[model samples]
Target chain A: MHDRRSFLKLGAGAAVGGIAAALPSAVSATECASNIKWDETRDVIVVGSGFAGLSSALNAKRQGLGSILVLEKMQVIGGNSAINGGWLAIPKNPIQLAQGINDDSPEELVKDQIISGRGMQNTDMLRQIANRALDAYQLCIDTGVKFREGFNQQVGGHNKARAIRTLHGVGGDITTKLYEAGKKEGVEYRLQHYVEDFIMDGQEIVGLKVRQNYRFPDLKTGKTIYIKANKAVILAHGGFSRNLVLRELVDPALDKTLDCTNALGATGEVTLTAMAHGAFPVHMSFIQTGHWGSPDEGGFGWSNALLSIGFHKGISVNVLDGKRFMNERADRKTCSDAIMKNRHPDGSPAYPVVFFNHDDHIGAEEVTRAVRDQIAWKVDSLEQLAKQFNIPLAPLKQTVAEYNKQVPQRIDPLFGRMMDTAVELKPPFIVSRIWPKVHYCMGGLKTDLGARVLHSQTLAPMKNLYAVGEATGGTHGGTRLSSTACLECLTMGIIVAETIKSDMQA
Target chain B: MMKTLLLTLVVATLFTGAANAGDLVKMKGSTQGRSNHEFIYQDGCKGCHQGSGKQNATDAACVECHGEITSIPVDESKLAIPEAHPHKSLHYNQGASCLACHGEHEKKAPVCAECHRTWFKEM
Candidate 1:
């Protein structure tokens, strides 16, 4: 292994050599007005190549920034944006031009966002995001992003079904289009680079130090590169959804179960780096946890699978000494919390088994088949199924019998099972074991309405440091609505670009 | 002096034998126990081996010689698929690597399809 000092020496040497090699023969007259290192000085430096980073780079170029640099830590350009369900929820988007969807106004949008945010939302921040959503959506459309039409519906708190999705299917498609657009606009995309930390001159962020992946066979040794920016550095690196330490630091309760769909690089390292440089992280405790999958299985939890299989409409009985505990039809989070409470006497990890009868199985089968063709469903007598699942047969039988007896009334006195699904007590019973898992982190580096990173307590904007996408938090107040994460990314990307442009011009 | 020389030869032989055995095992494992001729299929093995008529190719030789495997068109029709689902397209084109999702690795093939297929029920 190379010594740290030796590595630094090599990196410094390589950086100097690389600069000497790539530096323009003479400083071009059109270069930004700065005497900083030629390799370091760019009018705008975007610190990710996801939806937000790419958007910022393209918009910055459009805004006449002399030199634009997009640094991607991954080996490729698109970040998590390339791996997500490509849904962009813009309430009252102009793409509604072709479709007769309900038109939304900025005030209504603010109202909806505030309601979804549930008093945790910064109203001013939300208002800013709402006001510019249409223009951003239109901009995306103009840049070859085809918004899917006709499938608009309420996700979480929105009063109307105005969320627009990409025809490219999911996040990756939207990101690819944006990346292509950025490339067309001459955005210098550097991949396989990890941003170590922000270069700080006291409180102000001046530049960033990055390390390129030298592990490739072609490259002899990895090198550290410094990027100094004349105008601004936008952090579109995404949220800390996969960082356990950061998750535990922010919310201790989340330490128990926080399973996210974010990438491995989503370690919240960028957030910590920002905080180390005096950036405040807000809404740390606000986490999104609705879907519950099998703890043993590594994917979206079983509760979501069960919901997909119509289990939400079935009777859910929490068996404690052969007795029902909570109402079965309680909200998903509430149900998950109850299951967590009943894990074991010593508070071991809880695994709640969902029981359903033949009718419930049919409903579940319909839902599951619609989502995915591969789902293992078993049909057996209630007692036999209970025996197969290792649950006590007598108690489970009694629980199902009672649940079925109550089902005729069409109202569950125990768990408030609504939606009028049949009682799961008869032959051909099915059960799925599930537990709660951590999903997403709603807290990140504190930012202003313009997506500018701010000092924690003072609320002062960090100089030339902007944050968009999941890297910055302040948009989703306490809880993130279902599809708003993708929406937040695209809207904030456009917002940050426009803000940077205006700031530069001023 | 004779004992020391013999011991040195023994140690050196053991080390070299172990390394050669490991290499052979790895090569066999990669081809799923099939011989080089059967595993490589067609003349795919020749570009790396070059002048030699040997079927087996070294990792270094493969990287140095046939590094541009995608450029050697197996089929042009495969590339003409319409861009509908980027996630699916990434899976189809990149295979299984980080680039299938994150997008920048040039050499590593993206493996979104293999992993996501195993875990993601929606996929």
Candidate 2:
């Protein structure tokens, strides 16, 4: 039996200090001995029942692997993916082709992703995801998922209008459809089964030490049980945005004070557990704050979609000076950076207000609901809007007037924003205060193009260990563009299943 | 005087029984609809708290009394958005946890309200 100190010293590297240090002290003593009694075994085991996890299971089943199991630590099935805005950016998709938009190509999409990612993305991975994007989108449709009728949307940072949303406009729609499809295919799901540690044999991964009937935020609740996997253990556990300790370690600026948009179960324990078992970490410092988050709401609120619309149709102004700060159409990272930098005198976040004219063709239903719920306000005049948020009325009017004048020419002279789709400002504006919130982690276990997790020291692929989605980093570099997360998760999930099947045959 | 003394004794015994029912330690709020209800052997604390506070209230236990989540009647009139019944949510479907919104001993705010509206106080 190896002691806890010796095992951690041997298994972990200096690169994993942030993850290792952030592990709860109570669970630090729980170590997985190499030869543990197995309570159960399966052909394949998938951790975290989000888009990536469910997609991997379905693909594995389709590839003729039997006895697949999907484990979700949360009481609910979908992680953040369920509640996410179900927009998937795919270049040259059917919707785009049908709409006669022929300018888009996978290369063009990759170029935009690279730009949004600040050139720090893995080009190979980005190209791979971009290439298979259409196929991934088709897979969702085949699995009974339906996109919104009429037209596709161009999310921020995308050069083309390539993103398609689900009919219900929430990732839950896609997740529910996929889950139902997987269930019909005999893919087993177990909720509240938390994967705590990986079972290893020599340098290869073997199985998992999981806690069954686990309760959230209660480490001492569930009893420990070991489960064996004959084929592979795929990790699609999303990110650690909700894990304050890990977030603080990587970027001190992103501490507990900032509310996150992730589900409560997105604590990143599986990633930390994998790191404790020699998986290499990548891009740990690149955390993203959503620029559309509202201070009045919690989690991913309705204001998120409205604010996205505001970026195209309106402007975000500073409450103190009533001046436009940055390009509203800029990528999430750029917008968040601008908002954070435009702070109050006390160093608090600026929490700027985004407003668009009520009659500007923005979705009326959403605006009405937001106004009714008090998530957004619909003021009769510009003066009332200024007084509501405490902005100087003169500069507010001047800023809107300048925007209206510049936008008529189809270009923003001050901020370099393209105003081709924008319209002139009108009365009866709808407004919501916007602030940045910890939204996603663009970092996790490092993997090869095959989605096989690499070892920290040897830099070799850890046999029988695979990762996909936000659980594995280097896909989106420094900042992830909106609507691309779904694409990456679906693409990498299929790639992982194929890799595992081929490896097993060999 | 004798009648008053007997009534007080009975009230004290009932309160003590409810407090000592199971792991009521630090459990807050009323069980709403089931307040002041008597607990028998078949459906006491062990009914929902299967392992007794070690695990969350089981969905199966909830189903045993309330019925399958899909079939459970939802009063649309009680909902903020009539279409978004928390139990039969299009997103969660039947997988929504009863404990996520409802608390037995403690007042638990619905997780749905984190993104939506605060409609039901006891949910």
Please give the CA lDDT of all the candidate structures.
Answer: 0.59, 0.79
RMSD of each: 11.0, 6.9
Candidate 2 stretches greater than 4 Å from native: A1-34, A102-105, A308-335, A341-350, A355-363, A380-429, B1-33, B36-43, B51-55, B118-122
**Once model 1 is optimally superposed onto the true structure by TM-score, how far is the C-alpha of residue A28 displaced, in angstroms?**
32
List DockQ, one per candidate, in order.
0.07, 0.40
Best by lDDT: 2
Give one digit per residue, the lDDT tens place, for model 1 in B1-123.
533543464466466654421122233324321122223334454544445534222233433422322332233343223342333353122211233232110222233332244332211
What lDDT does model 1 reach? 0.59
How do the residues A1-506 of candidate 2 rate in per-residue lDDT, one tens digit apiece?
A: 33445434443432242332223323433444454778899999999888899889988998888899999988777888888878889888888888989999999989998897888899899999899998798889898888888668787888899998888778888788778888999999988787766777755777887767766655444666889999999999999988888888899877455778888777787888788778999998898887778877778877777876788888889999989999888877688778877677878776789888887745677687778678898888999998888899999999999988887688888889878768788888888988778988999999999999999999999999999999988789988988899999988878888999899989
Residues A204-252, candidate 1: write the lDDT tens digits. 6777666554322122234556678778888888776666655666667
Relative to the real complex, the DockQ score for model 1 comes to: 0.07
